[model samples]
Structure formats: C-alpha cells, structure tokens
Target: MNAVPFRRIGFDIARDVLGKPDILLLDVRDPASFERGHIARAENASPINLGRFLTETPKEKPVLIYCYHGNSSQAYAKAFSESGFGEVYSLDGGYEGWATANARAAAAAPRLSETLKAFLIAQGFPPDDVNAVGKNQMTPLMQAAHLGPAALVAELLAAGARVDAMNSDGSQPLWLACVGDDPEIVALVIKAGADLEHKNVNGSTALMYAASASKAKALMALLEAGADLTYENDGFSALDMAGSRECLDLLRAAQRRLKAAS
Candidate 1:
C-alpha cells in the first residue's frame, strides 16, 4: 500500500485547533514529558504501541500526531495512512519545537491597554493573566463584560478566552453584557456562543433580565438567536418580566420567529 505524505503544522495551527471541542491530538512522546505539560486536549500514545494505537484510532477524523522529536513518529504517519486512516500529520520539529516557538510568542507578546491591564493587576493577576481562569473560576472574557468596552472583550478573545465561560454564579459573558445593556456587546457574545438559555444564580436568563430592564434591543438580539421567551426560570418567563408593552412586543416577535423556524 502506498503511504500518503504527512503535513506538519506549526504552533499557530495547533493553538487554533485547541478551541475545537472535537479535535483529537495524540502526543507520542514518553509519559514523563507529557506530565510536565502537554498541548491542550492532547492524549499520549508513544511509538512503542504504534500498531495498537493505529488499529484502534478512529479513521474518520483527522489526527495530529507528535513526539518529543519528529524522527520516531514520522514513519507512523505513513503507517497510519497505509492502514486506512484518512488524515494524519506529524509536528515538524515535535513538542520541543512547539515549546521553543511558544516561548518566543510569550516573550514578544505586546502590552495590553493601560486601564484594563491596571484592572487585572489590581485584581492581583500576574502578567500572563489576560485569559487565565482565576480561582473564582472567572475568565477575562466574563470580567471584561462586567467592566465594558468592545476593546477589553476583543482583547481577551484574541488572547484565547472562552466566550461562553460561566462564573461561580453561573453567569456567562452574555449575562454580563445584557446587564450592561450594550446591544453590540450582546451581539458579539452571541456570535461567540453565549448560552441564550443559561440561568444565573438567581435562576434568571439574560432574556429575563433584559425584559426586566426593558432593553428591547438586547432582548431582540437574544430572541433572534432562538432564545426561549416562554422559558421560565423561577416563576416567570421573559414575557412576564417585561414591565412595558415594548418588552412584551419583543417577546411576541421572538415567539413568532421561533415558531417560524420550527
């Protein structure tokens, strides 16, 4: 059987794929090096058991395979491909190469905005705390929504922040944006996979809060994303919380849209 030549991806591609919940990565390096710190969501599978792994690995999805160095596993890529695995790749220089490249990026990373940087510092965060999930289980994305500005939210997202991160209170970035009543921020969070039906500690969804505040724009944004207006948290649906006729109108329109879609 003719083996397909493997493509070697760099750290950037690897980092991008880390955001995907379904992507599988196999680190063929030894167990000791893996425990120190490996790529996010990467699983260890050494060259010693290459045949066993190849036999069991799902051939449907693409698998990024790597070792400490590229030498040992380069041939496994060919072996996997010959064994009917659809897509297989080897990291060019391996984990060592990835570590060196990441170090350079870390060293060269630019300074963030003075105000937001100061806020993070005041929160007792280290220099690398931009996207770090703190002990409070709060991500910078959630913090930015509580603060303000498209800038802070954008910066954190660029720094690998998870948009749908829920705080200890179960309040996601979307909930914060709704509380801020910023329509643009609401849209941005929605695009980032903000949970429309997520309930906070008070058992209230973003739509319920928006309805309470009579924020028609924010309410409409959530509604358009298939948010359930009739979905009750505690004893009230968003429509029931709507104090004004406009809020009720928004809820009715959302109901119409949902009905149409289904």
Candidate 2:
C-alpha cells in the first residue's frame, strides 16, 4: 500500500529538521547500537515504542528515520509515509552521518588553525578549498584524514569535503586514513561513506592497506564496518599481509563468520 516514496535526506537537511520543533526523530538501530550513541532527542524504534509511535504521534509532525548506514531506515520511512504521515524522511548515511555531523558542529573553529593553514598553503593548496585538488591529486579532506587531530578532518567534512573523492590511483580518503594509521580518521570517513569495496587501479582496498601497514586500529575499524575478509589483491588477501597475530586472528574469525553465513 505504498503511496509516494519517502524522501531520503542528507545530514544537512536533517539538521534543519532538528531545528524545528515537534519533529519525530527516530533511530531504528538495534537497542545496543542506539544505546552507544544516537542523535540528541532521537527515539529508538523498539517494538513497543514503534507501535506506540505509529498510532500515537500526530501525522502532522515531520518524521525522520535512520538506521545503521541509512539503508534500513528507508523501509521504515516508507511505511510511515504510506500510513499517511506527512513529511516523512529517511536519513542518508544513517548514524554515521549523524555522528560526523555532530562532530563537525562541535569542531567549528574560525578557520583552519594557523599552522595547518600555513602548511596547506606551503604544500600549494588553498586552505579554503576543502575539495581543491592538491599534492598527489588529493583533496584537503584526504590530506587531513591522513594527518588528523580529528577536528581538522571534521572541519573539512563540515565544509562539504567528499569522503568518496579519489586521487589518480583511485585511492579514496579511507585508504590514506589507514596509511596514516589513524583509527579515528578511518572511522570518520567510513561514517562519511568511504567505500569498503572500492578497488583502486592497483586492485588494492583500504582493508588491504591497513593490514599491510600494520595499522591495528584501522584494520579493526574496517572489520567492524563489515569489510570483505576475503578480498584479494592479486591473490594476496588481507590475511596474507596481516602484520600481527592479533590481526591474523581477527581476519580469520571474520572470514570464518562470512563462510558460516554463506
């Protein structure tokens, strides 16, 4: 009984909805993930609560729904819209987008720090162009993901930097986050939609680079993001390049789970 399709909105639009009063902000993630972190004032769509929400909340109210990576929320949003709720919307990029959007809001400084700004200028990039191509054909965001204090990365992302932007070799920002071995930055770009399955011109993925470089935290982040444990670069899988016993065990366990599921 679907009517019009629900709109899928980015964080920017969601932020605007948040500013308005009486909007219904719903998080459809499992209870544990919702407990870990969720947008302020977001209601978890547990069974009993969802039933109550549908029958009780006024259809005049705008509804914004979100799930893990912004995928699952769409179904829920459609259901709501079909039920005749006006202004129903699904969040694009889900909880990841929400987390990064909050971080960006909190990271609002006047501009890049004097040191980082000078460094970017010295490297021949305009500090104000967050997406300007620079050394290695990298965007400022890619550079910051590689060289992060988290805030700089957040700020650049706030300025509309693309997480999916790739250099000539097709290496996304996520690849450089692993090279920089910064797990926080790795997670940041991931939430921002860094492609897990992206294969560069060399057939390498961020997961492969993380394992090869002995970047334990970055590797863990990729695994948690559900990266394919069986990915290979010319027959050299991440397992072959694992730098430590801990990494090896993680890859093996994840691989086993993937096998078991299939």
Pick by TM-score: which candidate is best? 2
Q: What are the clashing pairs of model 1?
A: none
- Where does model 2 exceed 4 Å of error? 1-116, 260-262
Q: List the residue pairs that clash in candidate 2.
A: none
> What C-alpha lDDT values do all the predictions have?
0.72, 0.80
Candidate with best lDDT: 2
**lDDT tens readout by residue for model 2, 82-195:** 888878999999998777765675466345667667656865786554655654567777777887878778767766677776676778888988888777888888988878
TM-score of each model, paired residue for residue: 0.53, 0.54
lDDT of 2: 0.80
lDDT, candidate 1, equals 0.72
Tens digits of lDDT, candidate 1, 1-262 = 5656666677666554443333457887789989997765578886677767777767776778788877766776777778777667777788898878767765666556677677677666655656554545566677677667877777766665666555667677888787777777788888877778877778888889889988777887887777776778767788888968998988887777777978
Which regions in candidate 1 have their CA more than 4 angstroms from the true location? 1-115, 122-124, 133-137, 259-262
What's every prediction's RMSD, in angstroms?
8.0, 15.2
Clashes of each: 0, 0
